[model samples]
Target chain A: MEGALMATEERSAKSDHADSSTGMLELRDIVKRFEKPGQGEILVLDEVDLDVEAGAFVSLLGPSGCGKTTLMNVISGLIEPDRGTMRRGGRDVSPDDLSLGYIFQEPRLLNWKTVRGNIEFALEARDVPEGEWDGRIDRYLDMVNLGDEHDNYPTRLSGGMKQRVSIARALAIEPEIMLMDEPFSSLDEITARDLREELLDIWKREEKTIVFVTHDINEAVFLSDYIYMMNTDGEMFARREVDIDRPRQYDDPDIAKREAELYREFHEHVVD
Target chain B: MDRLTRYLYTVASIIALLALWYVGGVTLPEVIPGLPETYAALVVVLTTPGPYGNMFYFHVWKTIEMLFASLFVSMIAGTVLGVALGRNETLESTLATWIYAWLAIPSLVIVFVSAIWIGFDASSGYFAIPLVITPFVGLNMWEGTRNLDTDLAEMAEFFGAGRIQTFKDVVVPQLAPFLFASFRSGLSIGWKITLLVEAFLLTRGVGFMFRRYFDQYDLPTMMSWLIIFVVFLIVVEYGVLAPLHERVMEWRPEAEGVRVTE
Candidate 1:
């Protein structure tokens, strides 16, 4: 298993050069701080650096309070880093220039809007051609297997279905990068597993860059081509290439072995 | 419970209350007028022409007009002001105290002030009712806007929604329940304030008629007017507002025997 991981890492390093030529998304020496009331300032992110190649599915895997979501926010232009530069396509990523789709831990759908309305809102916001709105919305909803629920309000839908709607809404925007912050973490095990498979299928079909943030090691292993493993201190301590093939199952022996090895790696950082 | 059972329970409660009122009227004739007398007075005023023509055609019409006008104006002004105050911290800090202060002052004070300024007329009722209702609506809306789910707004922003778009798509829909809440509460309070202003200052509407009947020692006429107005209020509340509220909030899942009070 170790040799397989090393071999995959070497292959990824070789491909990294080829992918970097396109300059998809780059984060260099990112730092963020927050004020803790009477405690003054606390550093949340410490000089983090990450580069995601175009159309790659990368996961930021760590425990709670590791600033994984914070990093996602910074990348999405929701929050400004205290220091460091974010570049896309070899240029500085301006808030206005970048097109991003974010899936929060919760579905965060507008309760008043039907699933179709939610997708329409995203389409209108992204300035998608008005003539194409219905087609795009129908396509994404069908992709997520929620084509029949377009007229149903979020409150009426089950949690898993609501999350699916969220996925459809995000995808309808046709974003350059999809930032997911533990979008499936709130679901039951079976639902989460099912959605994970659906998400991988979508990624394969759409070929969009995804920066998935999660604490679940198996999820990170199964979904990501490369996993940036961070410590509790909010630093990316290791990067591992998940050599497993596409459509990996949770119960697959190789995926489970990788998850166990990743857990060991995470625990070692905590001990250190 | 099913709709039929709910309606039955409501009707049963109303009948029981009317029975209690009838018993009280018989027990204390000086204080409470008998139902027969009140109903007879209602017939006379409603059918025959009075000093100001038919009481229902003129007085009740004027009062209803004032009630709706003030409600519309206050809803718009209060929602706009509340959204502003909720969004701006500086404005909230500067004006919140004043808003609460205005709310703390009784509607009677506004009625008196408006009467003195605008004179005893239909205009006085209009001015005073909105003054009394605006702060309540504004404060309720302020709370609603302040407690809006920011996560939804963030999602909107990430999808490339601008400020106005986000407010419309995200903020406004979330504020619908609160808007309805303020409207319901405002309607109830506005009617009382309009009547008070009319009784004390204005010489038109049902309130003025009530005052005139009371001054003339016409208990039957006054009790008749009270019954008619109360029934009207009940009808509007259940027929219009209750149905509207149910439709607006139908998307909410039924609570699991858990009561949430604000």
Candidate 2:
């Protein structure tokens, strides 16, 4: 435990020295269109723009049909923009230059593999050295509080537990940026709250850029450093930086105030 | 369900079969031999070497060899062909329908043509078995291939997975259940085609003994041979395929506990 704490301390010290003013990811004029079967083309992301600072947690807060997921897909380069320029460190670069870890609304695990094997699948895809695999799996699974359940299959896991495994799988790759698409929206309230705190704790220890997509106002207020509110027309019309302090609580007075302000802003613009 | 419940179901089926056999013996003695008489005939066939101057174990060994060899050959060929056809749209549209056309052509015609054209040998049975069973195996594989989850592929691609890793980890496991199902059914049909080829063309085999038995009107001996062979096949299918299905599909729900297989 002391050794792990020391390693984490060393990591945070190095990250603190690095640049934080510029966003790790910057998107401008990103537009994506999907063709309806019987009808014509419909714009899913209409010149959407976003910026995610290095070592900071950002939330894309929006209601349904607001293209929150489509924007996330554009940021991850899964869907090519009909017209846009995506840049890393304020310069355009190829996807090969950056590795991304994605957490879908569903766990999206390989049910045929054990929890350990699932993470190993990601590590192998990232081409982590074969010898370093065991330590990485142990650390990440332990971080997710799933060290003991590594041998279990996803089929036998509860919904919350499976989602935890997916989190571990993504973190195992140690990607440059973590992309989550409504990751906790499907879980029960208690599980979601618990995972939110766990995620915050991990974020504190290892400062990686995270772009979380959610429709829940409370979730956005609790987890993100900055919240970008998008409307149903796929336009990001508002942005806010939560002024509350860290180690936030479910019932913190400051959190409630931030949540109330966020809700008011969300209702004014995001609701259809 | 536990092991005992599964074992009991199998035992119950065997008892029902034995009861039916006893009734058939009493009602039609000349046609269906009694259990005791059949057992005695089986003992004779197993222990002795002389039946129309042919050794029983020799023929049994030959037929058993044919059964497995054909299945092994067909399984490899069919699975590879299925995966290929399933992944390629042009190949599927052009030749998938024609592949099943092999099934509609009777095994008898193929045997007669082979006899008239190439004459008789082990090669004839080997060719005939895979020809009869490949389409069934291939069809299941094609359907499984079509259902390959592209969402999972997108996830893998996002993770920077290479082509080989995607095929091994993602593609292969999804096709496993379909492959196992087709393999079992292939065994059932492939062995029959083996028998057809053996009886019509080959001279010194169990199929030849079957031909000789029919000629001499040896009902007890014929029934004994069939009963023993079928029992042998039942052991193989259950012992090998059932356990294999359990291992491959162990990640599935209720995989360990008893669920209704049928």
Candidate 3:
């Protein structure tokens, strides 16, 4: 009941953001192709266009090798597209200059560092001005509900906790854009479900732009305000604007029906 | 199997060895001296404080001092050169052949080279050990630093970590075990070579004491000093080397439970 209200609130907020900003990010005719060592050129992304308003939670849904990850990478300025330009805040930003927070599929936490240390490392590199660390670390750890586990090492934490730490590490930098590549794809169903809710809460609290890539249709439907579905060859084949109200519950009828329908749709597309 | 039984077994082994030594020395008078006579000599030498009595401790200290001096000098020089070489493929390839060939050159050759350059002086061992051991240390640490987790390296870079920050935060912490392992091996080799150099070079320490005993035809005194050297080696192995190793390995997060094997 509360989840539905939160979901509605999130949808309205996203709509407002979309209308207010021309677009925080605009992808112009992007194409990415890679050449294998011996194999010929393989087209990964095919003339993709994406518009993401600032502070919007958007999910890119597709099967494996669908170029969803490539698109995210291109948007993050980690990789260059063969023939395209990405404009952020109405200016062309180079890959080296853009500050995009990336969350890998693996936690990628420094094994030697504790959870707090891992988060602090992100700020350590930038000129974050000393003495601002404790407040920032505490704020994010509290958001992830990991305030107690600050001193715990990555090895000691559960997979879900490690992923939460990774998220915290990313958010500590307060990036204009956050790119997550199936960050919860490796976890068990129950933990993944809980983390999805936690992630939505974080997205709500911070209101930072997010681009999430996942093969799971239900995950996309449950979390995303807008779902951009991609084909195996890296084309943005279909897109769905979700209107499910905020704080959405997995058990809600609208969420369940939409999840099932998206699943069927993706399954059919993957099969054909 | 039991702790008490293990303790008893260890005590019994030592008692038996001592008994065999006593019996063998008494039974064969011409071949071996009695335990009493050896003990008498040991007591006289131990009670007297002079060059002979203090020789073993003095020599052990010399060897350790020289070894560490060489190690300290080489580690700084080696790590800097190694990181530079590891990051640049062209430099690595250019220097790889020369470095390996230099490493292959025997310690004896290096000792002779040190003698030629520095002469038979106090600095001989110091010069010799680092020259013999630096290449091996540099190469091993270079490879370890090169093969470090690239994903973590990328993460460091994405966080705007410059060379120094990457080294301190990412490289050092991850490469510590490897670096320490190389240090242990280098230290062992360095000290052994220092002792050999002491025996061959300027004669003032234990090596000089051994030579004097040999000249006087005192085989027992030579053997006693040999025993002292063995005891000194044991002390260093356990007291110094082992503790340092434990300290380094303690940095590992897994060291809390079962012993981490580096």
TM-score of 1: 0.91
Q: Where does candidate 2 chain B have its weakest 10-residue lDDT segment?
A: B253-262
Model 2 TM-score, 2 decimals: 0.87
Q: Which candidate model has the greater lDDT, 1 or 3?
A: 1
Runs of candidate 3 with Cα error greater than 4 angstroms are: A1-16, A19-22, A33-35, A40-43, A65-67, A80-82, A94-99, A251-272, B1-57, B92-100, B116-118, B122-124, B207-262
B75 Cα displacement, candidate 2 (Å): 2.0
User: What lDDT tens digits, residue by residue, belong to model 1 across residues B1-262?
Assistant: 8889999999999999889889988999998888778888889978977545665778888889999999999999999999899889999999988998898998888888888898878787778888889998999999998998878778887777898998787877789889998998998899888889778887888889889998999898998888888889889888988898888776676665322221
**Model 1 DockQ class:** acceptable
Steric clashes per prediction: 0, 1, 8
On DockQ, the stronger of 1 and 3 is: 1
In candidate 3, position B151 carries an lDDT of 79
* Alpha carbon lDDT of each predicted model: 0.84, 0.81, 0.76
Which candidate has the highest DockQ of all? 1
In candidate 2, position A116 carries an lDDT of 92
lDDT of 3: 0.76
| Clashing residue pairs in candidate 3 (N, C-alpha, C atoms within 3 angstroms) | A3-A247, A6-A246, A6-A247, A7-A245, A7-A246, A7-A247, A8-A245, A8-A246
What would the TM-score be for candidate 3 when compared with the true structure? 0.81
- Could you give candidate 3's per-residue lDDT for residues A1-272 as a string of tens digits? 11111112123335455533334676767888999789898888877777677777888888888888788777666677889887776787565555578898888888777788888888888767769888989998998888888887777777888888999999888786788999999999999988888888888877777889998887888888788777776667556777898888888899889888777766655566
i-RMS, each model, one decimal: 6.8, 6.0, 5.8
In model 1, pairs of residues that clash are none
| lDDT: worst 10-residue window of model 2 chain A | A1-10
lDDT of 3 at A56: 77
